[model samples]
Target: MLSGERLSAIRAKVNRAQCSQNKKSATLSSVSINGDRITERKKESFKTANSFIIRGKIEENETLTKRGERSLNCAQQRYVVVVNGKAHTVFTHRCRSRHCQNCQRIKAFVWQEKMKEIIPELSINFKNGKYLFITFTVKNPKITNLRLVLKCMSRAYAKMFQRKAFRFVVGGIRSTEITRGKSGDDEAHPHFHAIICLKTTYFKKENYLSADEWGRHWGECLEAEFKKEGLEYNAADYPKGFPRVDIRVAKSADGKQEITNKNIAEHGDQLINYVLKYSIKGSDLLKDGKADKWFWEFDKQVKGIRMIAPVGVVKKMLADLERDQFDYYKEQEKIEKLIADDVNFKADKAVFKKEDDFDYYMESKKDRFQYIIEAIEAKAYNYQCYYKALLSDHLLAFRSGIDGIIENFKKIKNTKTREGFEILEKAEMGLVKIQCERIERLQFICDALVRVGLYKKMSDFEYVNIHTKDKTTIAKNNIVGVMKAVEEKLLNDFNQDFMRLENAKSQDVFNTVVDRVNEKSALIKLVRNEILAAGAYAYDADNCEYIDLETNERLEVIATIE
Candidate 1:
């Protein structure tokens, strides 16, 4: 209805306003939505990572169940202690399952602390020493042959170090690690990282071996030892093969870093920590969605193997330090004590009490200690009763089995003559093997019983010496004497009947043994339930609950009253 120029001008103004409004809306949306999206992504990624971790644990548990081994059920259960209002300390009841991430982290932390102390001592002792970081490797082994390959590699490593070339090596720390190969390469890679110290003279231009030369030497030694051990080796995978060797000169300082004793010690700590950080990577086992099959195989293979070995003077030094520390800790009742005089005082501003005041504090809190000890004693008593009954039953079977073996040996001994001495010797050797194996089994069982808190201490059980005249006679008599002594001791200590049916003509012996065992089992269950119940209320009177530093969320205290 208006003129063209006027209408055009109004439309243009409206368009400009609309554009400005759109820009404002876009700015606001981006500021809010973009930040929210980033946060959501981060949370989602964390959740996904945790899912992978849990999946790995679930797989490990399944494997354990299949193999009849115990799985870690209480891996996340922690005992948290809050010091006044300032500090929070977290403690875990470590399950020590081979693949537990939390347990591994704790072990790594402890190892690092120990290494820190040991490194400075090394630097002082070996003032003119040169260090070398060496890695020894072999071809990636299939899951089925992982154990054999590891054994072969270990023996080879020992042989290599014993070679004349290694005589100049003064001390070293060796740690073994295993990792799963990348996606397409589906094999377990097992290798060793060693920090070896050498005399200063070994680094002389004429004496020094180049990195490549060192690699060649490693290969030759590994191959020769593997061949000697009757292990199969691929000729093609040698000299320039999959089993690569790495050798580097370790320095006390790098780049422009000034050389000082502290720096040198720190350098040594870094080298040691790098190798010992993980014996096996938990993340490698749970790559993608499922657990790697090879990792499980590797775990099973190295069950009882020692992954770290400190050799030469380092070994002795570590052993001495460890012994001293152990003795110190064992004698000290309270390793850590509260800093403040009052429970409600804040730790940040509180002054720590002197050692003289420790006894007074402990005396004041004697009730808590007494409560924990009583609970432990009650549980231990029940455990002892249960084990006594269980072991008594086992002893009966062992006695009958050993008796049969002795009877066989007796026949062989009685029938032996100087003319048939060779036959007698063979029979005696066979019997000795059987006896030693049986005794070892018994020792293992007894040790387990002690470890499980069923027994306070392990009793020494002497074995018969088979390398003597009248060996068979001595062995039989010793076996009989040992069994009789064990039976008597069990009865005396446990205050329970052994139920020697051979001596009892009563037909009720079986029923009597059954009743006793049932009674012990019931008592064990009752005590276990009581212990669990008491544990809930066993908080330290001095220590409060731990609070998460970041979230400021308070964690429930699971203090050890003892």
Candidate 2:
């Protein structure tokens, strides 16, 4: 009887186990192949761009169904690129991170594709096309004055390109690139790289002002514009400091720089490519963004109206306006209206007087040659270079103490270098050697002189005769004159024309003599018929100062009034 009960219990247990297996099998059979809804729901970030979408190659963002599952067919995709120059290939990839630099290549390619539609319509076939890449850079310690610098640059460039003088079609198509430079500040100081398309067939980018007759045209246009605004566009009086301003024009491809003082920006397709290099797809300085933080703040009142922008940005903007010639705010109001209207307007936009355009606005009034007489005055010594070209190619030689060549004057007759104050005892140039002839003429007076040395006083000076050698060589005598030539050159080279020679004992030494003549501190004292050294003096029509380059002396001699 006991054995029979055990057998019945075991039978009941087997039947329950069989029922559980049947239920589990049913559940497994009901499972759907598209099991993971999360994977299938992933959003695809791509537009159906113009090109053949090789179906197998593109990531369609579809379901994988299971691990390690891929599409039944998969291959690589190809794209054809026809630009102004040549055709190329484009491959697409995932931009894993927004900060990734590699992604820019694909982004640029896509932009090119979009631009193709536009370039075909806007561009006219020019015989030769060139692109000029113009960049507006700010000075170092950018955090302190970055915004003001940028504002000035923006005004200057926008005015330069958009003004009636520049006359490009709607400010030309512009692309913007912003970089922080190597300084590595949190501000990532902003600068702009502009690609200017200059239609060479119609609009020549580079015009030779020094050699060709183009300089007069360039100067006239600039002068009229500056005069209208009461702006001082004197090259001699442009501001001096770091973040030095410069503009370069060269062929769109590898070529020599354009030295001509004209609007030499290249135009057309080649220009487009060069411009695109800087006008790429990223910027640290954006007015608004959906991905990162950007602030529009407001402080203080403008005519009882509130203002807004990032505190630092607005602070800089206001400070920049303050730095201008007090008309900054009124001009800013004009720009505000333009900005509201979304049209390009600049300070150089045929504006009015008592308030010069931006170039003058940027240029502080306290420059060296603000005085009209000073503009034409012969320099004592070279502080930098005499007659620096503010617009065109003014050659400069920057050694410990050398300045570049001023136009037509390969060598200053007797003017000295401000840096070393070493008189040009000799000079050698292409097909022209001036100091040699001067050295020959100086031989006539060498017997009267004691010896030649650097910044040494010639003691016991007696009146002596010197000779000058032009096409006709003739000897001449000189009594009292000043070191005008030497002083001016020194000032031009070093921007310190009057470097006084001091006696350890006498403070009056400063008034008595200076190694350099043209320094702003250098006083020009006029005596009698003979001009004195280190004193404020001037010459009349005939009885004037004669610069003896050989001895580096300035002499005043009697002359018949012409």
Could you say which candidate leads in lDDT? Answer: 1
lDDT of 1 at 190: 83
Give candidate 2's whole-model lDDT: 0.29
**Residue 236 lDDT, candidate 2, scale 0-100:** 40
Deviating ranges (above 4 Å) for candidate 2: 1-103, 113-130, 141-156, 168-171, 183-189, 199-271, 278-562
lDDT of 1 by residue, 311-341 (tens): 7776776777753221211211221233223
Q: How many residue-pair clashes does candidate 2 contain? A: 50
Residue 53: error of model 2 in Å?
33
Tell me how candidate 1 scores on lDDT: 0.50
Alpha-carbon shift of residue 530 in model 1 (angstroms): 49
Error of 2 at 185 (Å): 3.9
TM-score of each: 0.48, 0.25
Per-candidate total of colliding backbone pairs: 0, 50
